[model samples]
Target: MGKIPTTIPRRQLGRRLRDMRQEAGISIQDAARLIERGAGTLQRLEKGEANRIRMLDIQALCQIYDRMDELPGLLELAKVAASKDGEQGLWWNEYSDAIRDDFELYVRLEASASKLTVYQSEIIPGLVQTADYARTLGARYFSDTSSREIEQVVTVRLNRQRIITRRRNPVEVDLLLDENALRRVVGGPKVMAAALRRLADLPANVTIRVLPFSAGFPLGVACGPFVVLDFDRATGEPPTVYVEGYRGNLYYDRAEAVAQYRDTFRTLQAVASSPADSKQMLRRLAREYER
Candidate 1:
């Protein structure tokens, strides 16, 4: 047999399937009948259970849901999920020792989001976090672990961005970082300086802005840090909000919660500096830290 690709994340297949099924408004029995599959089997797929995912099954499910664009990536991940080597976990599996189950779901949603807007309160957010910086936070805040494991997680965390950037249709990223996050010394001088420089260097598709301390506490202070995931499920797929508390991240698909966060985000943007000023701030921070 030809070698099976093993790079895919564990349960990623099921996660993607479940998200799409939920977004499409497909129920267990409805999807089962349309795909010529059993309801229990469909449930397992949606539950992130380990299973052999046939390309034909994926094709049928997508067609039933009328999601033609997702077919290619879905088929690719399915084949990898079925292969022997694919059974092995990605680098993220190591962190599962302390990571909450719901956070894993957040990671899955993050991977598939067409657009992401993050409001960071305490420190620099993960996507732009440098290796040393991520480790410092992981060691200090997360359950204790050795340096090697922390580094592995840092790698996976940074590499996960590849999912959006790699595709021909690059994901749109809007990062709103509080001014204090830039000032905080999570990893001390050297690491923080490097992280700031990296943040300033992000590409065109990625928009990084700073909510200045002068803005005087926007909506996020009460709400704290949250991630807003915008997906184009169909021609007009509304956005969703994902909030991570101390314990686990919660997915908010309810129209009311989504609407609340949406207005709050717009308020934040209006009060915060323009993109030009945001970049200027990052550049100024980098210069200050370099010294």
Candidate 2:
């Protein structure tokens, strides 16, 4: 078995470390000083970009944060992050070169999520996209790259859909697509028609609805694309909201922030067409595309 990416464990450890430091009201400089390390190093550790993590440093930080109760688990996570071997056979590793550094973390989180709630204003979400549709967007996004690289990117995306497509305990999906997504002629009308038909045929675990133009912005403001990832309690990871941007992505995990996004989703859901209606609408638009 090949070595798996330890990024997820590293990120989880980093989040816990940052949370503990904040909870204890310890400044990064102060904590770093006590740990006898540079502030930059501590920051990298908290960001999960640290290539090497020392058990002693983790213990000292735990002691300073008065979070000894969490020490054992933190140490275990640190060990895993620092180790060369991890779980085997994750497909993403095969296409690591195609994935952007910032987006890699989100992929890990998405794979681990028990449920996903998504909102897209202009384009179909990647998880639900057809191969040709994904390839079209991939080519545009990676215009400078070789065709092979673009294909790898598309493969990585299609692989991600497996989380929802797998037969055993597939992740539940609640996708809210703005009406504009349907009208957009991505990869031409033929591609759009095929994509919509696939969406209309999705399984029971996937609930897709369209927020029609008639709804006219239920929140009275345009909301960009975002995804909320809910994890199983056993993972000890908090629910996270991912906001993707042209330059960089943002993640919010604070309880209040997560709650606000949830409220926004519920509001949109109330106004969006019902799943049955949305399916009918999808088929209707698909037929139009066929014409």
Candidate 3:
């Protein structure tokens, strides 16, 4: 076991290994015995809960599963996962002390995603939040932390916005914001106004639509906030649904769960205002807030 945090590449590697093992019709216990390791250790590796992954172990498992052809890619994934320097290169890692492990995982996933479909019911999504809006939320959420620490959290959040603003192949973003998020004033009227204007003025890569109250429960129920992250197929990671909750967050990578969220998003999209109309509404709200 190693001390390094479980990373996205590590998790993907584990998932592929697990699938290969299952496809080969080998039980965990038998596979562990053949690899000269404990079943619990093999389980941890398959679950991506292992602190450190060994190349030798990966090779042994690949051999046992008769997946030699995949060894090269899996090995590469392992290299990336185990590389401390590579992990350090990520900008968010510098602020690890300011964020929770679950949040760190979310950030890593969000960074790698090629496309993002976000449905926010209350406050604005962090990726589009203005500095003041984010600072206000950070201050209350991190009430116990010092002002400097709160600032660090806010900085990390603003940095995340770069994924959509970056020059090279910026991530495609589709944001479905509930109208309440627009009407709800955060950080005072002026700050809220600025946040609305920012959303209305986002780059072409971002498509924002508002789900008005008149839509009347498009999904037939009150759905909370969730994000669907789709990665490049070359990464071998499945689409994921991130459900953020008060107590703990959940990540769903199973095909069925991801499909359900996607369908839900499409349904909401059908009822929501078009991107052009949404921007117009945002501008109108900003004017109201300015008054």
Candidate 4:
């Protein structure tokens, strides 16, 4: 069996192929019939879940859809999709054992996201967590996890931070952290101090705002912690909201749901401290932790 292509580009390409087929007024069954493959196979191809895709199959589909002009781009997408050795992309695949399978999709989306708006009430955002802070949380939460596995978890998180600092196209991160999150010591006073320092020294692309506990019951209070990831508009990938649960993570991409999260974020931003004030508050809190 051929290795499945799971990169974001491949998924985007598959989605584009599906859109083209639909625009040509072709049904999945008809397209599958044209290519002599099962309807499920064609469906998966369009959804980017297929373990493998053939350039010839893509060409045939394009021809059937009368979209010969799209052949070059689709073929190029096929080549890139087929280039993956296995599930490896952006380095997250290496720590698959420590991370949940379902969450990998979120990581993949995050890797390619152009912007991330994160609101956390209890802990530091993963993308910005320091190594000691991450290690402490990992050990506490995954009580049964081995030391090596915990380290691997930390490595994956620290590696993820690169997306924000990358030389080209750094992901813009907008974070609204509840005041309690900073006050709550994670690793210890020293660890908490270091983590706060890290957050304080974030690059220009990363924005942080602290929502004080004094600002009682903002719009996002009931919403809990969630992240909205926005991709490039050209890719046809809509903004996504991620909500984590005890059992699994839930993703919302529908326009209405996505809109609600976006609006809520804006409201929260209004109530949160300005960036300058937030940074000053972080410094003050760090000093408190030092004592």
Candidate 5:
């Protein structure tokens, strides 16, 4: 029918719909029957993978979920989700073939995040990484990946960085990095040095903290690299935790899971060097790399 929605808003609407259904104690099969759609179709809608969503279907589902009070906002979100594709398509959609579906979802959330709290144990966080640094790491780990594909990945990484630097209401970034991240030479000393210097030059809205080896593996050590994205409360979007692994990414929106990650982040912030101290550390590391 109309241009099927394929952006982040659609996915978010689906997630909200799913949450409403569960809160109403309705099963997927029951909900599907009420909407006169097959179980698979209903599942797709709830998962945000549906190409098209009829406004009438959304109204009916909201009624079934007894969420009439939220109808106005839900309708608005649906309309935005179904609008012309390219007009509002996410920037990362172009690199869809190069990244996993879960990563695509993560990119969507990252775009809308009002604030980002990240703890990176390995290399520099993507939000602050330089192009050379990103390409170096990508080429090393994904040696089998074609040069063109690696470039696409690097391009996407650079675009993601813009989220924090955009002029209008740039997302506030709080980064907690492990000391080892600074010492490891990702793209040789020159690239590593440049990256470290770049961190030192971040805008006032960005905060970087280095968790020294002396910190001795806090609770977050086992968690690996995870990001906690907080959205505008007015949007009714709950805080979310995104954990990345070798295979794919895992998303956690459940209150307990989100809280655990938040707590870990706070703890890490305490143990890591203060922002001022971290910047100085970065400068020193850059000099070391230069030498």
Candidate 6:
């Protein structure tokens, strides 16, 4: 048996594919044989119960299910699922932290993504947060959580930051911050000041944009916080979108929602400051907050 992803993104993608198949009015047996797998196997995959997916098998299913349009999206999830090595359950899970649930798929997808576009409505994006700043915020928000565990989480987030420029394929990141992130006072003024300096000091490729309260909300704001990750086809040939929320994450392979979010993001981009101006704004906030 293969390992299952303990996170929402992986399962959600599989669920979307299954829904699309049923909507097309295809029977499970036809899909299974077409994908060159057993009926039960196809059924399991559709239910988000499958451990791993074979590439040729997915291609076969895509053809039979009459979803040549969606084959690529399923392929990307296959790549993500393959990278997962089941983690030993962490002690911090006693509080049932939401981030813990996302840890596995978060790493796998980040590793594979060619470009990551993020809109952070509150707090610094984890990729750019300073250790003390992270510790302070994590400690407070996770009030019941012990300092040791919080420290471990801070370490994990900081460690993940190194992926900004990995050797073989340097990941590209475009992070948009709400102005509050720079002014929220997570670790008090001093800690906030240091955090801003760290954000300014990041490597050149990582772009930080601040959406000031003055911008008065862009198209995407109505939907709430979401990160859209772009993975150029590696083994699977289609791009996939991951949307997260408090309840769970949603993966969109359906044409409609994907198109809608893309349009929404484009609207946000239109209202956002240009790259040069964004950097300057971040620098200004850092100085302003310092005083």
Q: In terms of TM-score, which candidate is strongest?
A: 2
TM-score of 6: 0.69
- Per-residue lDDT of model 2, residues 192-276, tens digit only: 9999999999999999999999999789889999999998786667899999999999989889999999999999999999999
**Clash count for each candidate, listed in order shown:** 0, 0, 1, 0, 0, 2
Model 3 misplaced regions, further than 4 Å: 1-8, 21-44, 47-50, 56-76
| CA shift of 114, model 2, Å | 0.7
C-alpha TM-score for every candidate:
0.67, 0.91, 0.86, 0.78, 0.84, 0.69
Candidate order by decreasing TM-score: 2, 3, 5, 4, 6, 1
Question: lDDT value for candidate 1?
Answer: 0.72
Which order, best to worst by lDDT?
Answer: 2, 3, 4, 5, 1, 6
- Looking at model 2, report the run of 10 residues with the lowest lDDT sum: 1-10
Candidate number that wins on TM-score, 3 or 6: 3
**Candidate 4 lDDT over residue span 88-149, tens digit each:** 54477678887777677777788778899999888898899999999999999889989999
**Which number leads on lDDT?**
2
Candidate 4 similarity to native, TM-score = 0.78
Error of 2 at 158 (Å): 0.6
**Deviation from native of the Cα of residue 22 in model 6, angstroms:** 2.9
Candidate 5 error regions (>4 Å):
1-8, 29-41, 54-76, 85-90
Q: Give model 1's TM-score versus the native structure.
A: 0.67
- Candidate 1 vs candidate 4: which has greater lDDT? 4
- Runs of candidate 1 exceeding 4 Å displacement: 1-100, 234-238
Give me the runs in candidate 2 sitting further than 4 Å from their true place: 1-8, 33-40, 63-70
Q: Higher-lDDT candidate among 2 and 4?
A: 2
**lDDT (C-alpha, whole model) for all candidates:** 0.72, 0.90, 0.88, 0.84, 0.84, 0.68
Better of 2 and 6 by TM-score: 2
Worst 10 residues of 3 by lDDT: 1-10
